[model samples]
Target: MELSVVVVNYNVRYFLEQCLVSVFAAIKGIEGEVWVVDNASTDGSVEMVKLKFPQVKLISNQTNLGFSKANNQAIKLAKGRYTLLLNPDTVVQEDTFRECINFMDTHPDAGGLTVKMIDGKGRYLPESKRGFPSPWASFCKIFGLTSLFPKSKLFAHYYLGHLDKNATHEIEIMPGAFMFLRSEVLKQVGLLDEQFFMYGEDIDLSYRILQHGYKNYYYPKCQIIHYKGESTKKGSLNYVIVFYKAMILFAQKHFSKQKQNHFVTMIKLAVAIRATASIIKRLIIKVWLPVTDFALMFLGAYLLIPWWEQFRHGVTNIYPRDILYALIGFYLLTWIMSLWLYGAYDKPQNLKSGAKGILYGTIAILVVYSILPQNFRFSRAIILILSAWSSLSITLNRILASTFIEGLLKWNARKKSVCFIGTASELKGSEELLIQAGFHRNNITHLLPEEVLDEHQRAKKEIIADAIKYKNISEIIFGTEGIPMTSIIHAMMYLSEFDIDFKIALHGGDSIVGSSSVEAQGELYTLEVIPLAKPVARRQKRIFDILSSALIIVLFPILWIFLVKPLMVFKSALQVFKGEKTWIGYNHPNISKQNSVLKPSVYLYSKWGKGLTSTVGLDFYYAQHFSITLEVSELIRNIFKTQD
Candidate 1:
């Protein structure tokens, strides 16, 4: 074979499927065989390969072997000149394989080549190439000095910022997204070091290739879209611990003795410093600032009253300089107290927005100024100006600080991953809700159960084992409804063994309390209520009649008064014109002791004329009282009923 692609998959079945599909579609004419080494995926990953692409070779493990060992297992069976370690979450363009193969074929000195990888949203991933992590590089990266001094050559050397993305060049390390390696280079350097498990293995392998006098090229001629963090995007604490532990192992393997010791010492010192800083911050926020503000306010009142009294008569009593000094001292004291009381120096995370900060600060100043002795004749104008300045200053300070703090928090939090557990439908619902609520989809991993002889018991065990194995499930939610109580209990009990925290769906009549509940299909939960205190019948008719009449009057006032009335009059006149007479009359009849009904009656008279002759005849009928009003009332009532 000319090339062999090794993909190590673990519980990313859907992404893996898409990846394989893209690879096969892209490499149709390329000379290669695709090998998938599945690390015991319980999400039908192995079955998918068997059913859909039987021609491809698959190695299914009984348990999840780490990434390096799994890939090595496939590498042992590969018979190719070059071996490409590809992530299952990545999609290759049609030219990717051909381009990489051609590059390596032309450049005999190159040991490995990596293509430019864009994420799903078409943003370039910066981790494509990096300098080897030496003691200085590690320190710069850990302390965020590289980002702080991004344009400085000495500081950004680790990130290789000098290298342009549009050009191919030799680099110390390439990400494992699409690492195309020469089989001969691997034979000389040995397979990937499995001791580091997931993360550091790729770095170790790339460094080893460079150490053996082979160049690693960052080839941008071809491209692949990396979904990024598909496998390890959950269980923040576990991910951190595992990743750092792997880094330590890598450090032990590669770093010089002195550098290694210094790195370890630096890490320990950093932790201690962080803890002390946190304690100091708490003390200042909780105790020192509040006590200091109280003291300053008292001093301001004591000194301000005497000074103000001395200058109460006129500025001539004291020198101009003395009066100015007193005014400045009083203003400084007020400013200090206001700043402290408003939590100006508090942690950025605790800071409120401009409006809230101003509101609180204003209230504090008002109380402080009011309770001071009446002898202190403070100028109202000075107080107003200082208060406005203080509000603006404090609010702007908080806004700037919060922006910086939030950015840092988000950057640090991005490395974390979370695993979700539930059926497909339940997980989809949960995912939609979480996405709407601002949780990134890349951080979510679904833990699915495998088929077994005893499905219920096996499912419970599988879920528990997956949680333990992945060790990154920050929160487990039972999203499925109508699950047996026993199953729920089993799941909860299983999760509790790992000291995992979880939430369950809230059912009928059950209050969620601290938990959140999302709206489900066909499930109605009242969010608000509008009380219909009065009888629905009367309220509906009155509202309808008022609204309808108002709209009609506004839209057609002239038509109602002139055109409609004149039409009726013309009809009456036309009867006279035709030699027939008509009369419009009203009659009142008492229906009950308190109620009377009015009815309108029309009578027609037959006429005799030159062209038309008619005998005198009359038809009389009593119109039903309350008929129009009753019809209108019924229509309004039905409208309200339909709305309900």
Candidate 2:
């Protein structure tokens, strides 16, 4: 074989599919075999390839052995003159593979080469080449000073930013995405060190290649898209912690004791400052504002209600002491119910904006007052006073809540990383769009096609496995064209099994419609929204349902017993008093006709300790007969009529 393409797969099946399709498309005439080493993907990735692409070789491991060990497994089995480690979430242009092969062939001294990388939006990734991570360089990176002083030679040296992008040059390290190596160079350097599971393995391999008297070239001619950091983005806190731990392992292996200590101290200091600032901000918003508002509302209600009563009633003390006590009790009960039903005391600093909270507070008060007996009722003036006070108080509370919560949400959002897999030009475009759309650059992790495991026969399987094992990929975005529909479907099936959200990039082709559907899991339905639809409406409906259900449950007992039950009982008593013995029947033209249609019945009942009284009522048999006739007539009319 001329070349071996190794890919370690985790759970990013859709992205892996697009990547493989692009690779196969690019290397159409090239002499090479693709190797996919699968690291125990629960997403059915192994099954997908077995069913779809039988030409490719696959090595399915029973467990997720780390990136280096798995890739090494495939490399040992590879029979190619050269090996390429490519990420499964990446895509290559038609000319990329041929160009890389020609460049490596011409430059015999070059042990490895990495192509220029771009993101889904067609912007160049900054992973073309990098310098060795020295103590000073690591410190500069940790402090973000390298980016701050990009034009300065001293600062730019850390990221190797001073290097020309138009020309190929020797560099200390090339990103793992497109690490192309000569089989001879690997023989001299030995296999990759499996000690570093993820982050440090590529660097260690590159270092060994150089130590064997070979140059590592950064070639910009060959281009590929790297969908960086797919595994870490899934909101798994453990993935983030593991990635950082891997970085520490890298530092410990390479850096001096003093440098390691310095990096550790800097990280500690940064975390301390961030935590301190957050705590102080939280105290000012959550504790101070809510307490102040509650006090203001209490004082305002006490003063306003008395003044309003004096103005309206003229003689405020006309009500007896017992009635006054009842009025006070009702006010307290209503206020307490409002607080509970309206979620008034729920960390006001975390509440949403708009009229939702205010509306709930108003409804709670109204429902409570409507339920209580008329003897316990306060003047309408008191209700008005409470309403105005509560509305203003809750609104003000939410405003403060919004300010604090929004800041916290933004802070949390900054920690999330997204990776795009496609061609370099495409990724560059994606990166630009994402930045314009408010994506933080620091959170983006690019996985270039070259970084995928090339020696592995099951490249897709290995790439997906590595993505899940090493990178904290929260989501995978496939950016490519002419990708096979079957492969896409296969990838989607695998991702669904893992509960991973995978999205395909729409590159202006025949639009894909009717692709969205819902999967029912018991009472919970997983609605797979098509990538094209705006997400706003779905989120809005969810909020509405949650709020409506909570309000109904909170008000059920009070509303049912006080208002609804009384109205129902009064309506029943009124029918009996009018000498309509039937509970539900029409009044007749003649008494005899009515008697023939509906017979009356009498019964006796007692109330509290009162004596029993006989009550006239409708006979069950005749009432049922008339009711059935009326219902049948209504059904006939409904069926025949065009309009209601």
Candidate 3:
């Protein structure tokens, strides 16, 4: 056999499926067999492999056998002249396998090879061609000298800076994502050292290949897309700990005790320095908005309100600085925490998320305020004004920043560019929905009617691939209505060459389901991340309803004479305040005959608390959107319309 492809999979079933699709297409002319060794994935990957690609061999492990050990399991049984260790989260181009095989066939000296690779975002991974991570190289990498001086051979040598990324060259390390090996060399140098679990085994194998008198080449004639493993988070303490321990293990196994001690010291110092920087950067990013808002609130409050004053020497006792500090800290923490609970920073950094974050944050702060002691309390009115102003400021800041980055800096304001491919009927109204859903205005879309994309006479994959190539579309969304799943998957396989994204638009409203590039759990779709999906209910939904209702009950009683008509109109709303009914919904208890029609906004949804008034069936729009501002607007309109 020419090749034996070994893919070690752990839970990334969708990615694995796509990778296999690409791999099958890649190894067309070669005599090859694919082996999938699953590490006990509960994501139906085993079934998918068994059902979809029946020809391929599969090894099922009950527990997670780490990458090195899993690959060795297949290596022991591999029959091909060459064994290819491949990551499940990768897509090989059609030429990738052929070129690598041809290169190895020509170069008798080359025992191991890795081709050029890019991430899902199309960024060339420097890890694709790296130095041996010698003490100096590792130092440069950990301290970010590699990025700081990318062109300088000394500082940037960790990524082999002197060599061009597009050129084939001798390299010391090969990423486990795509390690092509000669079977004879593997037998000589031995299988990957299983002692070093996941991260360092590749390094150990690469180093041992050289010790056994073989050269490893970074062949750039072909390229593949690797979604890049993300087991450890960057700049996290756990990342530093896990990764450094791996480094120490490598040093102890290979280097002298004195060198190992030095390596350990270097690793510790680097981890400490980098982790501290990571923490500070995170804190600055997280607290900047709340801190600024706090400052503005303090300024606004001091300017607007004044307590009793003493005329002696024209001076009054100032509010204690310690108390003011305490108040500011309390408010800042509450507001920031509330925004976090509201998912303000989820992604696509838009008006709606910010508006909703502040709205939910305000409600949270109110809850906190009610629970605080009299001595801790300050201006509630100022807080209300602060919430409104903060929302406006935060939104304005995001708009300006996004505009500057997109317009001036020529960066996409939002990273994911979507292509809405739909049937003619589905296309008519979806563009506006997608645009409003935070996709760039210039996003490409294709309308191939059912007749055009019929199974018997389906549009060629070349046509779809060309469109994707031209638009540089990052995400492909199929209208789930008329399009068959087989066609969708077929089209996906055809255009799988690009390091891009895929999603499916649900039929009814604006909801779209898609795969997550960040996670190994495949084919999981969440409205929280995808702005195109329906608005998610706030975590503070019940609290806001209950609190808003209580305030209305208290204030309405005092102003009942003036608000007689409103009170009569708000009788149902009053019931909401009393907890007898909800602040928004579809069902009415008493008024079964007169079903008043309420116009739809994004926020109207049946699952939400019943409001004072809404159009008939309008509450079901929670399936589309739900926002505090949208709710308030409808409530005002409903009240005034009753008088009319």
TM-score per candidate, in order?
Answer: 0.45, 0.52, 0.63
Put down candidate 3 lDDT per residue, 1-644, tens digits, no spaces: 99999999887665677678778877888899999999987656787788678988999999998888999999999999999999987777666788888899999999899988765444567888878878888988887889999877899888898799878899998888899999999999999888866788888899999998899999987777666653223335666777777888899899888878888899988878877886886676666555665565566445433332232224444456578667756665666666555655433334566677778778877888889888767557656766776677766655654543322112343555667777666655556555544456656567564533755544467766776778777777677566644455556645667866776554543334444343222232322222212223434444555676666567776645554365564575556555565454334321121112211121223333445255433322442455666556555544443333
Candidates in order: C-alpha RMSD to true structure: 28.4, 20.0, 11.6
Q: What is the lDDT of candidate 2?
A: 0.56
Q: What lDDT would each prediction earn against the true structure?
A: 0.57, 0.56, 0.67
2 versus 3: better TM-score goes to: 3
* Model 1 lDDT tens row, 1-644: 88899999987655676677667866688778999999987656787677667978999999988999999999988998999999987767656788888899999999999977655434456677678877677677667787887645577666676688768889988787788999999999999898977887888999999999999999877766566766665223355456656767887888888877887676555445545665666455455433544354445444544455466644432324465456545655555544443334443223332334445555655676677666453455445554555455544444544453322111222333556555566566555445433357887676543321144433355645575467676555543333432343345434445544344332221111111111101111111001111122223323434444444345443533433344553454344333343132212211111111111212221121213232211111112111224434433332222322
Which residue runs does candidate 1 get wrong by more than 4 Å?
267-644
Model 1: colliding residue pairs: 233-417, 233-418, 234-417, 234-418, 235-417, 235-472
Q: Which 10 successive residues of model 1 have the least lDDT summed?
A: 524-533
Give the lDDT of residue 477 in candidate 2.
Answer: 54
Per-residue lDDT of candidate 2, residues 433-511 (tens digit): 4553335787666655445324431125356545755766555555544333223333443444344444455343111
Clashes per candidate, residues 3 or more apart or on different chains: 6, 73, 13
Ordered from best to worst TM-score, the candidate numbers read 3, 2, 1
